[model samples]
Target: MAFKLIFAALAAVSLAASSGAYQLPRSDQLQPLNPPIDNLIPLSAYIDGLLTNAERMKRGMGPARPSKFSDGSVTRREPSSTPTSPSNPEPTDVPTTTPGSGVIRIHDPSSSSTTLYWVSKDLNNFGEYGRTDDISKALTVTLGSDSGRFSIRTPSPACGCVSDLPFLGGIMGYATSGGDLKSSSADYAYLGATVETANGSPAVSGDNSFTRATGISKSIESSIWSISSDNSLTATWINADGAMVDAHILYYAADNVLSLTADPVSFVNNFGASPAVVSSWLSDSTLAVKATAAI
Candidate 1:
């Protein structure tokens, strides 16, 4: 037991002496860890070396060796010229994508059929409409001896253009001959309240002034024409099958074109059957009106 206790005591004392808790060493025991410094590169030269190699490294090239003759000035390399080929010609101005402006619609009262005419404008969508220096000249349409194209039911079937509408012929006639329809007080001269079968069928207004066109026949049954307070003219008619056809024609001097809009208003108002909703040609490209809830 005594031998074991003595061995433990000696072991504790030996650990304490080797644990770095002893007194410090004298200054004579230390030595220099590095060689004497000399011949160091100047701060400017070191910085220039770094800068020179930085540009080369960025360009994926090896750094140049330091030279005594180098002025340490950075020289930028010019960009390489791009090769030109026939397949890669320079770009040019892009063409315009706008559509033509003027359009006209024609309707047939007998058939309740309608046709669209892009009058004055390019029907082929090429670019623009035909420019008319004088709209008065463009509207000067002379009456013809041929039966009217707009006739409903008679010895001859319907035939005529929008200008052939009742009362329009005299208006166009006077306009072409340098007569202003707006200032004309010839109240009941050209037309009367009722159709004068003796004379060519002329469109009569509520005030009884009617004008005759050459081709229009007097066989119209349920046709009515009215002039609005603003001088805008509208003609309504019922087809053979009771379809309501309305033609609204207005003159726009600024655009030098006549805007004629004709459509079938109430198919069931006269015919008594719920007609199918008119689907637009744009339906194919349109999105659904009712949106679905997103997940």
Candidate 2:
């Protein structure tokens, strides 16, 4: 600490009024420690040596620091004040573990969680519906037209897996284009984990707009975004039949595709049941409501 002060003083002097302009008077100050000295010159040199050593020791005690050099000039003056050992509030040992952290554990009040929602919007039209049931397998429904090539994506063993219930409520809406009836589209969502292979199928909701696509169907224009919590992200979904289809489905501007499956047979037959029916399709990738969920 003493060495730091001495260096600071030297540095101040070094930067003081460049050599050319002005001349200042020097003050004769008393020596610190009150020692009766003989040669002031030797004492000054000794003080300098001690400070240099102190500086070196300070640096050596820790990680490498920026290098400092001397200008080789010294001015005679009184010794500086007693070194002021800097005061720090002591380091705060933040916990290294989460939830299960040991030692002086601390909890952040700002922590939060959220539930992802698969919402279905209502678009006053006939809910699209088209599906292929394999006697002992699963049900497969084609998205509106060729919105995307994905069959075997509905709730039923024949379709390969079952559908899912949204984190919140299900959907119920009209379809601009009738599903399966046109063979051009079998509007129905696929429930899965990632989109490829599904844990199970569930009522789908990507498109939400009531308009159709240009040169395509207007029902596919309903597009809405899915949001979630911050701390953790969930990329999995459970099918409606209470099984894990383990498939994934994503929507965006580049890929305008969506599915809606409301068993036309049970549009009214199984209207009110567990994990209600979700019948709706998209002109592109947007999904409309009319889908259902009762759990």
Candidate 3:
């Protein structure tokens, strides 16, 4: 009888141990989910990682994007860097695309830093200095009905890019480049536009533009000045119809200064349409659209 009782007690303990809380597991704190941003990551990737790790250790995580990434469970992606760096000058030993080639590498104009390829070769950025927008994400510039694309890595670079810093609200600032324009470019400075979630309200949305160049950046600046607008800053550039003009802006950032520039637009003339004209192109007889910035 004693042996029988002891055996029953032991069996009960064994069952409990096999199905204890530790065994069941804690589903609430699931492991972090990581998505591949392709091999050879960029500063943006690293910045993304740091923010994610920091956020993951917290409670009540939110979405990544309103379109897709937002609803999925929150998980941190690794920053494509050494996990840390000082301001822009500190080089984060990361991978990069060759210059004038592709973006295994890119230059951060704001600080002349670098990292791997986040650049979009939408048009013909050629990944050179002063060839594309400095503030916006790699532009999706296009040319020819065939739908080709290219990228501009930096207005200027110092090898690697400044480490990505998500907490800073997308590197708040206006980005001006010493960049030039290319033929395989877009009518607008940039496209495939995306709005900032934080900057939401009944007001003006952020906008960037490109035009066919009629004059030099220095000359255009002289003719272009702001008159007035409800918005904080207004910049204007001068160019002729069928010329390439480069102008870009990124609003709702953490900074005040606006980076601005103008370069001539280009045309492969896919249809060979009478030597490519601006969206608002005019005949010589008609007024060349009065050059004025409204208040």
Q: Please name the candidate that would achieve the greatest lDDT relative to the true structure.
A: 1
Candidate 3 lDDT at 129 equals 17
lDDT, each prediction = 0.25, 0.24, 0.24
Taking the tens digit of each residue's C-alpha lDDT, what string does model 3 give over 265-288? 221121111111111111112211
Mind giving the per-residue lDDT tens digits that candidate 2 earns over 1-295?
9999999988777766565434443222211211122312221222322334453233221222233448755543334567444385222221112221111111112234232122121111222221211111111222212222222222221111112211111122232222221112223332221122222334343321111111112212111112223211112223334443221222211112222333322321222211222222221111112122322
For model 2 the TM-score comes to: 0.15
Q: Candidate 2, which segments miss by more than 4 Å at Cα? A: 1-232, 247-252, 255-295
* Model 1: residues with Cα > 4 Å off, grouped in runs: 1-224, 248-295
Query: CA shift at 257, candidate 1, in angstroms?
Result: 9.7
lDDT tens digits, residue span 208-245, model 1? 11111121112222133433333223444333344444
lDDT, candidate 3, residue 72? 69
